[model samples]
Target: MSTETPAVRVTDLTVAYGELPVLWDIDMDVPAGKLMAIMGPNGAGKTTLIKAILGLVPPAAGRVEIHGGLYRDQRHLVGYVPQRGSVDWDFPTTVLDVVMMGRYGALGWFKRPGKRERDQALTALDKVGMADFRARQISQLSGGQQQRVFLARALVQDAQVYFMDEPFQGVDARTELAIVDLLKELRTLGRTVIVVHHDLQTVRDYFDWITLLNVRRIAGGPVDEVFTSENLKLAYGGRVEFLQRQAPCDPPPDAPDLGSYPGRIRP
Candidate 1:
C-alpha cells in the first residue's frame, strides 16, 4: 500500500436532508495526482458526497480532511465546479467575469481582481478553448459552452485538488473530449481531481480511482480493482444483473441505453 498522505480523506462521514440520510458512514482516501470518480444511481448521493467534502453541506456525523488537514484551512488548495443546473445561468455575468471568481480566494476580500487576475482568467479560458467568448454573456452560451466556462473557472484557481460535479453532464461529444483532455493534463501535472460522474461506460477511460456509492460507499480503489462486475452490480442493483462479461457495458433497461454502450469495464 502507498504510504503517502491522501489528497482527500473522508472518515465515517454521514449527511442528511432533515431526517432522511443521503450518505452514511462513508470512508474514502483519494491519493494525490489521480483522477477519481464518485458514481452511483439516480438518488445515490454521489453529488452529496462531494458537497460534504467541500463543506457545502453539513455532515451529520464524521470528518473530512484534505491533504491531512481541515478543509477550511485548506481552501486555497482546492477548487470546485458545481453542477451547471445548480447555478443561476440567467444571472447577469460575462464569461470572463465568471472565471474571475476563482481568483477571489487568493485575492482576499478588499482587493479586486486586477490585470494579473484577468490575464490568468483569460489564459485558463484559452486552455479550455473559450477565449474568444470571454466577453460574452454567460446566458448566451450553449450547454457545452457553459460547461467549458466552468472548467476554465476551476483551472484559473490553480488548485492542487479539484472537485467537479458532473462536468460532462450536458456537454456535446467534443466538449466531453476536451474536458477529458484537460483532466488528463491535470493528472500529468500531479494534481488530484475528484469528479461526480454518471456514465459507467467512460469511467475506465477517464478515471484512475473510483468510489462506488449507493447512499453508503460500496467499494473504492484503483478502477481496475474496485470497478468490477460484482461491485458495480452491488452499487447499481438490478440495473446490471445481466452483465455476462465485465468487459462490455450491457446497461440494464432503466439506464436509457437500448443497446450496448462502448468503453465498458475492461477485464
Candidate 2:
C-alpha cells in the first residue's frame, strides 16, 4: 500500500530444529501487492518459513527483512494467519474475542483494547463476512467459518503484509472461493499476501508467484516459469506421481494385480 520496497526479503536463510536442518539456503524477495504461494510436501518447512519471518521461531542462519528493515522494527505492518489446527478452538472464547486479539500486538504490552479497537475488530469481522457470527463461540462455527474468523483476526491488524498458512485446508467450495476472492482483493489494495497452499490444482489461478521448497530451495519465481511438471516432481517427492496414477479417470496400471511384487502375497 505504501510506496516502499519489498514487504519481505529472506537471504541465505537456514533453519534447524535442534541439529536437523529444515530449510537450507533460502533466498526470496516478495514485493508489496503480490499474492505469493508457497507449495511443498509435508515437512518441507513451509510453515517454518512463515514462523521464522514472523520472529516466532529463530533461524540459525540468514536474515528476514520486512519493508527494507528487520521484521521486529516493522511488526505492525505484518500479520499472520496460522493454520486452524494450530489453535485450540474449543477454548472458551467468542469470535469477537479472537478478532480483538489482533489489536493486542498494536496496543503494546499491558495495554487493554478500548472502544476504537473493538470497532476495528468488528470492521475486520465484517470484511470476512463474519460480523453476524461475532457473538458466537468459535467452537460453534463450521471449519470454514472458523477459518474466516481467523482471517478476520489477522485483518484486524491492518498490516501491509499478510502471511496465511493453508487458509483453504478443509474448506468447502464456497468458503474457498470467498477466501480466494478476499486474497485477490487484498493484493488489489496493494498489500502483499503470502499463502502456504496445499491444493496443487488451483496454483495457477490463485497466485502470481510460486516458491517451491523441499528441505531446500527447489525453485521460485513467476508461476508460469517455475511451476512446471519437472519442478513439481522435485517439490512433491514422488507423492504427486502416486496421486496422478490414482485419479478417477486414470486408474493404477496394476490395480488388478496388486500382489505382483515378489514379497506381496495375494489373498
Candidate 3:
C-alpha cells in the first residue's frame, strides 16, 4: 500500500433527487486505514453519500476527491458492496461467477478475466470463508452467506478504499462476527473501510470513527466522543418518540393492534 494521503475528501457536498435536497453542506475528511461508520436514522442520506462518492449518483454541488485527486482519476482505487437488498438473488449465477464480476471494472470494455482473475476471486472467497460454496448457486445461500459472497466480490477488486452499505443487516451473529474480523484485517493492511451501519448498540464496539447524519450531518468524530446522547437525540429525537407509539417494521400477522396507540396507523 502506498499510504500517500487521505483516503477521501468531500467539500460542500449537497445531493438532491429531482430538485429535492437530501444532503446539504457536507464537508468531510476521511483518512486512510481506519474503519469509519456512517450512522444515521432511516432516510438520512447515508446511502446517498456513499453513492455520490462512487459516482453512481451525481452531486448537486460541491466536490469529492479520492486519494488526493478527482474521483474519475481514482475510480479504480475504490470498491463497493451495496446493500444486499439492492441485488436480485433470483439471478442465475454461481458464487464464483458473481465474485469474478468485480474484476470486470479492471478488465475494462472488451477484455475477459483469465486464470489470474479466477485466482484472485478464489482468494477473496477464501478470505471470507466462502471458498467451499464458490461453485454453489448464489440464490441457494442464506442471507449471511450471500452477504459474505458480496464482500468477497468487493475484496476481489483489490481496491484501497472499500465502501459497504448495510452489510450486516439480516445476518446472523456468527456472520456478523466474521465480518468484523475481516474488517479488522483490512484495517491492518492499511485499507480504508467505510460502512453504513444502523445498530446503535454495537456502533461503539465496531467503528473507530462515526458520522452521525439525519438528512443533514450532526457530528462526526471518534465514537467515544461523537456518539453522545445529544447526537443520538439529533438523529432520532422526533422519530423515536413517534415510532415508540407505533409498531416495529413489518409487524407479524397476529401482533398487537396498532390502532390501540393514539397516533396514526396505516391500513
Among all candidates shown, the one with the greatest TM-score: 1
lDDT tens per residue, model 1, 203-265: 777899999999989999998888877888888775453343433344555445433332332
lDDT of each: 0.88, 0.85, 0.84
Q: In candidate 1, list every pair of residues with a backbone clash.
A: none
Instruction: Provide the lowest-lDDT 10-residue window in model 1.
Output: 258-267
Better of 2 and 3 by lDDT: 2
At residue 156, what lDDT does model 3 achieve?
92
Per residue, candidate 3 scores C-alpha lDDT tens digits across 1-267 of 336567998889999998798999888878888899998767889999999988889899989998899989998999999999998998998999999999999999999989999999999999999999989988899999999999999999989999999999889889998999999899999899999987665666688888888778888877778877667778766433222222345444544553332132221
Q: What lDDT, from 0 to 1, does candidate 1 have? A: 0.88
- True-structure RMSD, every candidate: 3.6, 6.0, 6.2
TM-scores for every candidate against the unseen true structure: 0.91, 0.87, 0.87
Clash count for candidate 3 is 0
Compared with the true structure, what per-residue lDDT tens digits does model 2 show for residues 1-267?
236577798999999999999999899888778999998877999999999888888999999999899988999999999999999999999999999999999999999989999999899899889999999988999999999999999888889999999999888889988999999999999999999987665677789988999889899888878877778788876534333223333435654532222111121
User: Which regions in candidate 1 have their CA more than 4 angstroms from the true location?
Assistant: 239-267
